[model samples]
Target: MDRIRPWLILVGVFLLQFFLSELLAIRYYRPDFVVIFILYFGLFFGSYYGVIAGFIIGIFIDMTPLASYFGLSPMTYSITGYLAGHLQDKYIRWSPFAFHAAWLCIISFHFLVFTYVRYQLLFEVDIVQYLLRWFLTMTYTLIFLLILQFFFPIKRIQGA
Candidate 1:
């Protein structure tokens, strides 16, 4: 069951994201629940698993009929996972501010690339609109992350 647990979580999140994401959408802004799961796995399990999970989950998402770009999701999610995974054990050595900043930057980069690539090809979007969409999506996702932190903060265990 231990081996299966992570995959189960992946499937659950994928299903939830697929079926329920539309309901969560407010115009172009919607929380990326899949990225949250990838972040969790990467942060806890390290880069090897993180990148793998990201790639697999991303491919699943891309395979869906709703996906626009073929390789965008996998590329972005894999990069974010690898970055998050590298910071896993190092969080303990850093100051609180620095740690938070690292994650904030990672999340910002993820949303920035995601939103930009998505809009750039579909339409010739203005800079203002691109920035707004990026900001709104990142903000919405961060709100969910904040709520998650209350219940289960992302911190390293003492002697795992």
Candidate 2:
């Protein structure tokens, strides 16, 4: 049972993503549940599980009609998972503040990538405006993270 916590979290997150987003979403600034779980498993469970969870979660997300591009999420999420998971395990075990900061960074990076891919603006686009949008979305993600953090703060892994 202990071995399957990540998978269970993935499933719960997926169900919440599908059913709760519409209700919880505040206009265009919906929190990314995928980011939440990805960050959790990545930071707590290590990169291997993080990548696997992100890949599977991305696939499930793509199956929904809401997904703009099927392939985008899988790529972006898998990478996010890996990067988050790569953080020093010792740092995570010692400090909640570190965990919070890392969580923000991972989620912010993900939105930047997600937005850039959606726009594909490259050199021609207005950089400042795009950045502002990214900042706002990151802020939105942070707010959700703060709320979730209260309920589920990371503890040291038993055997890791």
Candidate 3:
């Protein structure tokens, strides 16, 4: 039960984000809450857990209406989570600037990957419009990250 508690929390977070994304219409262009959680876990827990969370969330995301391509999100999210985990290991600090920078990178990566997949696999969309939408979405995510960081801080573990 104790071991499963943490997993439940993680799952709960994912589901909350998923529902919010759907209800709030965050899928048009922006950072995914699932991706943010994946990055957060990866940064805190390490590669193995990050990969697991990413995979699970990716599956959920793929099943969502927002997902156009079947497997692209899962694969991209897994890679992003793994990389974030590795970065956390290499760089052990919790500065606000660092958090913002990391958030920007994650959001940017997701935008590019999603756009590419949509362009190549799903439909013929205008790149210029997509770019504009991506920019707006990324901006929104950055602002949201700032707000979230203040409200729910990420605790740094000792010797981590």
> Which has the greatest lDDT?
1
Per-candidate TM-scores read: 0.93, 0.83, 0.77
Give every collision pair in model 2: none
> What is the alpha-carbon lDDT of model 3 when measured against the actual structure?
0.69
Instruction: Summarize candidate 2's per-residue lDDT along 1-160 as a digit string, tens digits.
Output: 9888768878998998889877776666666788878877787778887888899999999999768888888888998889888874756364767755665677778998898886667414788877777777677777777787578754443223
Once fitted onto the true fold, the runs of candidate 2 whose alpha carbons sit more than 4 angstroms away are 92-100, 121-126, 155-160
Find the 10 residues in a row with the least total lDDT in model 1: 151-160
C-alpha RMSD for every candidate: 1.9, 2.9, 3.4
The C-alpha lDDT values of all candidates are 0.85, 0.77, 0.69
Q: Which candidate is the best by TM-score?
A: 1
Clashing pairs in 1: none
Model 1 local distance difference test score: 0.85
Q: Over all chains combined, what TM-score does candidate 2 have?
A: 0.83
Which has the better TM-score: candidate 1, or candidate 2? 1
> For model 3, what is the alpha-carbon lDDT of residue 43?
76
Per-residue alpha-carbon lDDT of candidate 1 for residues 25-125, written as tens digits (9 for 90 to 100)? 99978889988888888888888898999899999999997687999999999998999898887766888788779888989999888887889943364
Q: Stretches of candidate 1 above 4 Å error?
A: 121-125, 156-160
Which residues of candidate 3, in runs, are more than 4 Å off?
Answer: 89-103, 120-125, 154-160
Better of 2 and 3 by TM-score: 2
